[model samples]
Target: MTRITRRLALGAAAATLAAPALRAQGTAIRIIVPFAPGGSTDAVARLVAPGLTQRLGAPVVVENRSGAAGAIGTDAVAKARPDGLTWLLTFDSHATLAALLPQLPFNPDRDLDPVMLIGGAPYVLACKPDKPFRSITDVVDAARARPDAVSFGSTGNGTIGHLTMVLLQGRTNTRITHLPYRSGGLAVNDTVAGHTDMMIGSAAVVHPHARSGTLRTFAQFGPQRLPALSDLPTVAEAGLAGLEAEAWWGVFAPHGTPQDAVSRMNAALKESLNEERVRATMQEVQQARLVASSPGELATFLAREVAKWGEVVRANNIRAD
Candidate 1:
């Protein structure tokens, strides 16, 4: 054969060999949301699933496998075949589960490959509108004066909301009672009903009441205050500098997944995040910002979160079991 003909023949053979791998990458994608449907994490997963399907040219499905503060489904994805077919859509809890529930079936860092940091939003601390607490300063003052008289409700024990309070207590050298609820909505409800003195959670969970005048927002726990709530002060701005605590979500796949598959999914996710509908749903409905970060960036972020929260968990002796 001529030199050109030989080169063409070799290229065709290589293409044939790569055909199976390409097909595998196109297989239906299963996204595992480690929380119940209708929550923010599920919202993010469902919001992006259709766009992912369009971009990757394969059906995308989001399955809720809720339990153990998202450890069950996360473990399932961690143990899944690393063919990139299965992925985990999890919230900030993914990084702290190891510290909270030491009995987790899988090591989040070791068993899963970071795909992307989808997005994050800071939690807000709110109180009953009629309560005397008007700001973070008032809350801290009252808590310090009355000790455990200022009770706070959290989504649950060992959750970000709860830990943020613990961190606050350590920072201000104050005492506050912690009331753990099964869900953030319920926690917010109790606070609004005057059953709890205060509650801290995402805007979706706690801000609506503030807007409605049912609950009063005392402070937001983020690096900077959100423009929508620009009048409100951040926890740092209020008094506690360096006390920013943002709840973040991210996607992960089983370790050993092919880099090609990871890259394809990552690209699809980035595109989906940029979709107008997806962005609107996250911003308006779920109250989260879109953070489409690379796999390496996500890995670094997760490590930092794990270390930061792990210290709080250890110091406070927080545990799920």
Candidate 2:
């Protein structure tokens, strides 16, 4: 071939390779929440979607692909085209599931790239108002005294709430029976009805019951006490240090998404998390703490969380069944 013709062919090949990157810049983005609508993951995704849409100049949609302990929707995001148009907004459970479930269709760390950490809320240990326990120590004492008699309810067997209880048992050296329910709402319902001894869940879910005196607040699983629920002490303050578990949510895109798009999304998320309405709504819904983090920070956080929960799951022998 002539040199001029060969050079033209090389230029055409480079442009062809760049075409996908250009197309990705103009596509609408879809944030997939691997759980049912109206949950924390979905709520956070919706809250941030508008801002992202505005920032990226593309329609941002939040889709709920709930089921299989969140594996179903997560797999969907993992298998989606790596063109940066589709993403996943889920909680720490996604990371835990990667470590706990050997059959996960997609490897969270390998198949997905972290975008941003939206925010999180500490799990509150609450009980029926009429229950005898008044503090974390009291609950521990009772669990120690009664063994399997003191049972706690959670969203499901392998959920963060369930694992939080497992960590509690491991730390306190107490045995408390777990009563898994279909959802956090159901678990909270039973806790309020006195059917379950107590429940560990997001502050948003338990705050209303505690305010209404249907459930009594014992302790929160966070680094520090929440502002709205200042009357309640943290697990550490209640004499159990180093026990912090927050229901964290974050955004992730399929691996191989352009770095430019990831950076843009991260910037938008950081801005959205700081918005007054977003903060207020999160507080109103679930008393969640607003934490916007960069992609690298979120990746490190997820890795650490995966390791932390892996130990808890192994020690507790917790499973999906």
TM-score, each model? 0.85, 0.83
For candidate 2, what is the TM-score?
0.83
List model 2 lDDT by residue over 1-321, tens digit each.
999999999999998866644565657788888876655666678887898777677788888877666788889999999777899898768767855677877888799999887778899899888888888889888988889999898766678888888878888899999897655667778888889888888886778778777888888998988888888899888778988888888888999988977887787787776788977788766687777888989988888888888778777666774
**Which stretches in model 1 have alpha-carbon errors above 4 Å?**
1-28, 192-194, 212-214, 284-287
- Candidate 1 versus truth, CA RMSD in Å, comes to 3.5
- Per-model root-mean-square deviation over C-alphas: 3.5, 5.8
Model 1 C-alpha lDDT per residue in residues 32-64, reported as the tens digit of each score? 998766556776788899998887767899998
Using lDDT, give the best candidate's number. Answer: 1
Our model 2 lands, by Cα RMSD against the true structure, at 5.8
Clashes of each: 0, 1
- Mark the 10 consecutive residues where model 1 has the least summed lDDT: 17-26
